[model samples]
Target: MEFAQALFLVVAGHNDRQEHLSRARRLVLKVHLSASLSEGESVRFLPPIFGEVRLIVHQFLDRLMHDSGRPIPIFNQNAGSLDRRMDKAEFDRFADAYEDQHRENIAVTGEGPEYFAEYKIKAFREIVDRAGIEVNRICDFGSGIGNSIPYFRRYFPEAALTSSDVSERSLALGRQRYPEAGSCVLIENNRIPVEADSFDVAFSACVFHHIPHREHLTWLRELHRVTRPGGLIAIFEHNPLNPLTVHAVNTCPFDENARLIFARDLAKRLQAAGWASSRIQYNLFFPRALARLRPFENKLGWLPLGAQYVATARKV
Candidate 1:
């Protein structure tokens, strides 16, 4: 009778453990499916499912380790062939639907795409204004569809504006949208197609992440080469440390190939590319819901929790 009772308890414990694991797997799969659908990918695709399975397993192990009070091991999943890199062609394809897709992705923030674009230009203007530096020529690097043209005109009316991008289709769209903004220059072979030391400011907004990590230095060097002495090279990028920023990137179709960089890392890259007085400033701390608190955002630039960051440096 004692042996039978012990056997029954062991079987019941094993069944409970199995049930727990099954529940965990279902939860992981549900989350994975939601994310995949949001990204505009079909769950029926085998590669994505396989990737999700890997993530699910890792998450389960992480939870187990946490419960055991042990340090969790990180697993970096190589996207392999399943993840394709975006290039000029991809940008061209995205150009037509970029605005609509961006609107949809950022709907949760209760702001339009132009608001984001304008803020970066506004922030850069403030930085240079405080330093008493007058910008006469501005080069908008990776100026997709000339979204920044109106803002550039609004803030730096006297400065001559030049737009440059790798996507010809996007440039065409920009030309149509802003005929008075002049011709948009095309970048070829990672080159800016412009004279050296020609601009007072070389600005890029959320463009670097789309670029290959190995080629970041080359592009930074190009921007440095185009910027005159005492001129500013300010770049705005999505802050990966912020959960909302991560979600934004994950859902944005154009950001499929994005590899986010930390502000400190970008600052170091700027130094490596022969830039001087490099500084990092975080931005977009408060959403539209809390616009009343935005006045305090300027004082919070040192905080790393902002939705995006601007890494600024000067050529000297």
Candidate 2:
């Protein structure tokens, strides 16, 4: 890593007294997946801008560190993965029931597609900074109404952004809101209808949990194929350990706890697929007990901690 890149990562990796970074950095590998790089891929230009870009990530960290009054997200043990011991159709139907009931509120309100999207995009900007990533083709894996498109346009404006969704209705709604931002371009490409191993970054947000556990490996491996060697993929999910999150899952739309997959599970997922684990960071600190301590969650800061987590890895 270049001096500037290293500096930016260390800063982005920071939480408390730098000891947090010691733990966080273990999640964010200073080590690169050298074999994943092809002859044309080199870290030559990864330094200067990396530092400037990471400044954005630090700003995000600052905001997330502040305790939000909401209960931290929880792992909905009820939610099933593709590796189903339970009914796959029933699992999806349960989640879809929530989606169907409050389609408008869920899409336009609550976290406001843009709210979560903006926060998540900022996080990825940090990952790209550390990964020395520059992509020509990108996939917004859980492309929700194109909220993530702006982030890609701002950073990799020239790259083709392929937005995918299981539901066309959602994409249509997305186009209506963010037309100029390539919400429309997504339809021209394929999501369920398209071939695999196509795009560069298989950027996902809050979508993996909906996928049954059995299919996680296949889905990730397919993502690995669409990109060129050494490509980067970032996965964003709620932290099960957070406080307010617990409340959101039981009371909210899905009636399923946001499946907060542990970081260890995340590591196994990446390592199994031949990708080197680069950086996994904890964003929101939403402690579970804070559910009852609502008024105090934000004030205590250190009390109910971290409901959001991010995993950024490379496809080797």
Candidate 3:
């Protein structure tokens, strides 16, 4: 059977909205007609024209539920193609939907709110303190729901705080939760509305993994641009190599499209963005069952077995 025909046959039995089914049928016909094209008779069979076939196949289930209007632009031309950046509007839609779905427990995934609020944020604070970076003005990029507010207050009560994110719902909730944040900026198109060299300390927790890998260095450069020459930028991301971290992200509805990043990879991206003194420190080595072992996690920084890692670099 032809490729598009086979794909249509596979999806034909599924129950879906009429509009969705119509779109799917049209999509199938579009590809089937493309596949049926005859060779140019150059004594050679032309390579198959699979213009948007790959996209339809990947998003078959997604099309059944909601249409993203313009399908996400697929820059990859083949299986080996690497570019995966999404347009700003698409990312904004994703962020808005994700936050709306998980607003009640945005910070309380994997384990729960108590553990995330106490252990995870506390460990990040310790990492920051140990690095001994002075904090006067701080910006929490992608600070959804302001889960880090309490910890930021505990770590540097007097520092000016700014919470920024693409989701207005998240920013509203953050502002409600942490009134002390003088600025609750809504970011668009990866452009931070704040002035350059405005913050002394810029940090993001579990934010980069949600960003497409192709734009990682560009975002890092933005972080660097907004930070003072001697300021610090700390990035906390899920450790891709850790099984529990992998499972958590894979299972989390909000993280359905997330791509976990490695500590070394994050450090390299920061370096490429003109950051200096890049360092990676692994954390969350033990589950709550072995809470006492947490104290010893400091010594295991050299090990890459942690559930998450923090990459710290100085802006130059």
Writing each residue's lDDT as its tens digit, candidate 2 over 1-316 gives: 3424533443344224245434333332323333124324564556654444344334333333443543223222334533335332333344324334534433322344445567677767767766787767777775755557777777677777777766555566656656766533332222244455566676888777656655677667766766667788888876544434434453455534345565557768877877776556766442233335544433442321356667778876
* Model 3 lDDT tens row, 1-316: 3444534443343333455455655655554455555335431354443434344453443443345443211111221125554433434455445544544433333355445545555665665577676778888988887777887787677788888887787787778767776688888867899899999888898787767777788789888889988888878887754545554564456665566676787898899989998998887876656777778988998887687788999876
For model 3, the stretches where C-alpha displacement exceeds 4 angstroms are 1-111
Clashes of 3: 0
Query: Could you give candidate 1's per-residue lDDT for residues 1-316 as a string of tens digits?
Result: 3323322332233225445434544555565556567664564555664664446343543343244432111111121123544466669999999989988999899899989989998999998887667899989999998899999889998989999999899899999999998557999887988889989989999888877666789999999999988888999998865656766776578877676776888999999999999999999988899899999999999987798999999888
Considering summed lDDT, which 10 consecutive residues are worst modelled in model 3? 71-80
Clashing residue pairs in candidate 3, if any?
A: none
Local distance difference test scores for all models: 0.77, 0.55, 0.67
- Model 3 error, position 246 (Å): 0.6
Q: Each model's TM-score?
A: 0.75, 0.58, 0.67
Query: C-alpha displacement of 296 in model 2, angstroms?
Result: 20
Question: Which one is best on TM-score?
Answer: 1
- The backbone clash count of each candidate, in order, is 0, 34, 0
Candidate 1 off by > 4 Å: 1-86
